[model samples]
Target: MNARIAPPATVALQPDAIIRHARAVIATEAEAIGALEPRIGTDFVEACRLILNCHGRVVVTGMGKSGHVARKIAATLASTGTPSFYVHPGEASHGDLGMIMPQDIVLALSYSGETDEVLFILPTLKREGIPLIAITGKPGSSLARQADVHLDGSISCEACPLGLAPTTSTTAALVLGDALAIALLEARGFTSDDFARSHPAGSLGRRLLLRISDVMHTGDDVPRVAPDVGLTTALVEMTRKHLGMTAVVDADDRLLGVFTDGDLRRALDDVGVDLRGATVTELMTRGPKTIGPDKLAAEAAQLMEKHQIHALLVVDADQRVVGALNIHDLLRARVV
Candidate 1:
C-alpha cells in the first residue's frame, strides 16, 4: 500500500504584521546598498581598470545564490559592451575549466569567501596566469586572499527574519555587479546606439536604431499628387493610401505642401470655398514640416508631437519627396 503524506499546517495570515515585516526587509536591503557607496574606492577602481584592459571575456563564477547573482552580472556586462559570461564553479572542475583561457579574467562571488566549488577552481586559474577578482563579505577568507583585486560586499546582516537566507548580501553583490557594468560602460564610451545594437529585439533597439527610411512608405506607396490636382482628387489619393494626408508635389516631384484631413475639415467649414473647384495647393498647408529619410523614426515622432501634426513628408537634400509617414505608420512600426 502507498503511504499518504500529511499536508503541512497553515498559519493565519496577518496583514499588519506582513506589511511591517516587508517594509523592514526593504529598509535593511536599502541600508546595505547605501553602505556600498562609500566603499567604492581604490579596489573598485582597480577592478574596473582590470576589466577595461581585459583582452578576453570576464568569466563570472559563484555557488548557490551567489551563482544566481553571477549570472545576472554576466548578462548585464555582456549587454553593456563588456564581453562576459557566467561559468558554474562546480562544472569548472568537470572540464568546463577549459572555457577559461589565459588571457581572460575570472570574477568570483561568495559571501563567506569559503565556497568550496569556487575555491576548487582557484588553483587552475592561477596556474594558467588568469587574473581573479573576488567579491566576498569575508575579507580575510581564502578567496579574497587569492584574488588580484578584492571587492568587499559585506553587510551587517541578512534581511531574512531567520538570518539564514541570502537577502541583503545578495542585493549588495547585485548592486556591486551593476556598478561595475555601468562604470565599464561609461569608461568605454558606450552610447545608447551601441546598447541598442546588443538588444535588437527590444523596444529600446527599435527606438534608437530604426530610421525613417526603414519604416516610411516609399515609391508608389507614398501618396503624392501634382499641386494642380483638385481637392477631390487629392482626397481620393489620401483615402486610397489611408495615411490621412497627401503630399502636393511639383512636376519634378519637389514637395510644395501637404493636404491633411484637418485641411479638408477647415475647407468644408469655409462657406466661400468650393471643394469641386479647389486645387490641392489652394487648400494644402504650404512648406509643411518635413524630415530626412536618414533621420531616426523616433526623431520623426518627436517632430510630429512638437508640431501637433499627424503626418510628415520625407524629403531629400534637393527637397524631393522620396517617402512619407504618418502617426499610424509610426504606430505600425512600433516606433511611437
Candidate 2:
C-alpha cells in the first residue's frame, strides 16, 4: 500500500475506450475515401448522370444504424442543390410506400445488403418499376443485385475486434453519398447562389440573398450634396450622415463624383488648395467606387476592399443615387 490511498476502479473508462476505438475507425474510413478515387469508374459517372436527370426527390432508406447515416445523407443532398429525403425501410412497407413514385429513385443502404426491413419493401418498388440504387459490401446480396446501380461501400475490416458494429461500413456509406452529391453538383453546375436558395436562413443565404439594397442607408439618412456644394458643406453633410462619405450628385441625383475624408486630405496636401472656399466640384474625386443596388453585399464588400474604399454609394441601373453604405454596415448586418 502506498502512502496515499488509491482511487476505486470504475466502468467510466470502458466508454472512453470506445471513443479511442471510434477514432481509429473514423481514420480507417477516411483512408477508404482516398482509395475510392482510383476505384471510381464509368459506373460512378453514369450514376451521377442518372441523379442529374432525376425529376423527383431522392428517397433514402435503410435499417438500424444504416438508417441513421441514410437520414444524414438525405439531408446533405437536399441542402446541396439536390432535393432528397429519408425514409425508414420498416415504415416504407407500411403506408409510407405511398411516398414513393415511379419518377423517384430509391437509395438503400446496408452493410451486408440483406437487411430484412429493407428487403421486405424491394418487391413492391420493383413491381412499380421504381429505379433503385444500392450501397453495400456484397454486390451479390438481394438488394444490391436488384438495384439499377451498385456503389461499393465495402471496407477492409471493422475497427471493432468483434467486427459486429456497422462502424467502417457506415462511414464508407456516408462518404459515398457525399461523393455522389458533390459529383452531381458539379455536373449540374450548381452554384452557391442555388445552394443559398435552399438554405435562406443560414449564413450562406445571408451572404447571397441580402443585397446592398437590404442593408444600405437610403433617403434622408444618405449623405448627399450637389456637385457645386462647397467642400465645407460636403464635409458637414458627411459628418451629419455619419457614413464617412458623401455623394456629389447632379440635379437629377445622377452621380457626379464622390468626396471623402481621404479626398479632403489629398486636397489639403495640394500646393494651392483652399478647403473652405473650394467647390466640391473641384475637390471631389471623379468616378469613385459605386455599386448597383441589385448586387450582393458580399460583392460590395469585395469591391470596397479592392478599391480601398471605406464607403460606397448604391445606385440604380441608371446610375442615379439610390442609397449609401459603409464597411460597418456589413458588420452590423452580420453579412461579413
Candidate 3:
C-alpha cells in the first residue's frame, strides 16, 4: 500500500513542451532587446564620455550571468581601443580589488540590483572615490542608488514560464553594455589596425601587421640560376635553397622564369629525356607568380593559395628580382 492506489499515468506531450518553452523565451528576449533602442538616455551618453576620458583601465564586475556579460563587455572594450578588464565581484573581497586603481572607472552589473557579491565592493569603491556605472533592473535598489550613473536594463517580463528566471533581463543588460562599448569605440575613432595591435597572436592580426619585407628571402639567400646556366646547376640551386623552387634571372637580376620540384618531376617523366642538351632557358617557366617588395605578406599568401603555388618571386617596381618567398616562409612568419 505504498500510495494506497496506483498513480494516474501521465500523458505524452503532443508536440513537446520543452520546445514551446524555449521558443517563448527567445521571443520575449528579442522583444526586450527591441525595446531597449528607444530607451537610451543622456545617462548613457555620460557613461560613454566618462569612459572615453578615463586614463586608466575600465574594471567590469558582476555576479552569475551578469558576470559572463561583464567579461564579454570588457573584451569588446579592450579590442575597440578602450582599455578594459573584468573583475569577479565575489573575488574583489579576496584581494583582487588591488587590480583597480583610483583612476579607473568601475562598471558594476546586477539584475535585481540586490546581488550580494556586487554590493560587497560598494564600500571599497566609495572609499576609493572611484567613479561607478551601474546596469540593473530596479532603479531604486541599493546598487543603483549608489552608482554615479545607472543604466536602466529593465524588461517588461522574463521569458521564463513562471517569470522567475533572468532570461530577458540578461539579454537586455548584455545588449546595453555592447551599445555603450560601441559608442565609446566610435567616439575614440578606433581602427582595424588598432584592433590588430591588441590581438597580435591571431591569424587576423598577422594579416594586418605582416608585410612583404618581413617574410621575403632577400639577396644572396635567394636561390637564383642564370638563364644561361645548365639545368644541372639550376637543380643544385633549387635543392640548396630549400624553397621548392628556383628563379631564373639574368645578370641584371631581371626574372626570366621559375623551375620547381614539379618541373623537375615533369622533366623526368617526359617521353624523351634531353638532360645534357637542354638549358634552364628551355626547361623553366617564364613569368611566374611575382609579388612586389612593398606588398603585404597577406596579399602574397592570397595569391599563392589562389594559384595553389608554393612560392613567389619578390621584385621591385621595375620587376627585377629583389627577393623570393615561399609558403614555408609565410608559415614561419605566421603570415599564411
Candidate 4:
C-alpha cells in the first residue's frame, strides 16, 4: 500500500512580525559584512598576489551554499579582467580534477573549513603543486592550516532564526570574494573599455564600443542640399530622407549650415518673410552642432540632449559632410 502524506500545519499570518524579522536579518548581515573590513590584511594581499602572478585561471571550489557564492565570485572575476572559473568539489574528486592544472591557483570556500568533498581533493592538489587559497569561518581548521593563504570569514552568528542555515556567513564570503576581484582589477589597471569587451552583447557594450559611423546614415541616404536651394527644395530633401532636417553644404559638400523643421516653423511664423523667394541659406541655422563619425554614438546622444536638438550631421575633420544621424537612430540601436 502507498503511504499517505500528512497535511501541513496552518499558522496565523502577522505582517508586523514578518517585517520585523526581515529588518533584523538585514541588520545582522550588514553587521557581519562590516566586521570583515578589518580582517582584510596580509592574507588578502597574498591571495591577490598569488592569483595575479599565476599563469593560468583561478579555479574556485566549494560545497552547498559556498558553491553558489563561488560561482558568482568566479563570474565577477572573469568579467572584471581576472580569468577565473568555479569547479564543484565533489566533481573535482572524480575525473573532473583533470580540468585543473599546476599553474592554476585553487580558491576553496567552506564555512566549517572541514568539508569532506573539498578536503578529499586537497591531497591531489598538493601533489600537483597547485597553490591553495582558503576562506572559512574557522581559522584553525584543516583547510585553513593547509592553505598558502587563508582569509578569515568568521561571523558572530548567522541571520537565520534557527542559526542553522547559511546566511551571514555566505554574505561575508561573497563580499570577501568581491573585494579580491576588485583589488586585482585595480592592480591590473582594468578599464571600462576592457570590461565592455567581455560583455559585447550587453547595453554597456553598445554604449562604449558603438561609434557614430556604425549607426549614421551615409552617402545618398544623408539628406543634403546646396545653400542656394529654395526652402521648398530643402523641405523635399528632408521629407525624402525622413531625418527631420537637411544639411546645407557648399559645392564641395562641406557643411555650411543646417535647415531644420524648427527653422521652417520660425520662417512660417514671420509674416514679413517671403516663403517663395527665401533661400535655404536665409533660413538655415549657421555653424550648427556637429560630430565626427569617429566619435562614440553615446557622445552624440549627450550632445543632442544638451542642445535640445533631435538630429546631428556627421562630418570629417575638414568639415566635409560624411553622414547624418538623429535621436531615433540611437533609439533603434538602443544606445539612447
Per-residue alpha-carbon lDDT of candidate 1 for residues 33-141, written as tens digits (9 for 90 to 100): 9999999999999999999999999999999999999999999999999999999999999999999999899999999999999999999999999999999999999
Instruction: Give candidate 1 misplaced runs (Cα > 4 Å).
Output: 1-5
In candidate 2, which residue ranges exceed 4 Å CA deviation? 1-27, 262-278, 316-319
Q: TM-scores for all candidates?
A: 0.96, 0.82, 0.83, 0.97
Give the whole-model CA lDDT for all candidates, comma-separated: 0.95, 0.88, 0.89, 0.96
lDDT of candidate model 1 versus the reference: 0.95
Q: What local lDDT score does residue 235 receive in model 2, on the 0 to 100 scale?
A: 88
| Rank list by lDDT | 4, 1, 3, 2
Q: Going through the candidates in order, what is the number of backbone clashes in each?
A: 0, 0, 0, 0
Which of the two candidates, 3 or 4, achieves a greater TM-score against the reference? 4
lDDT of 1 at 67: 99
Better of 1 and 2 by TM-score: 1
Q: Give residue 107's lDDT in candidate 4 (0 to 100).
A: 96
- The alpha-carbon lDDT assigned to residue 327 of candidate 2 equals 91
TM-score of 1: 0.96
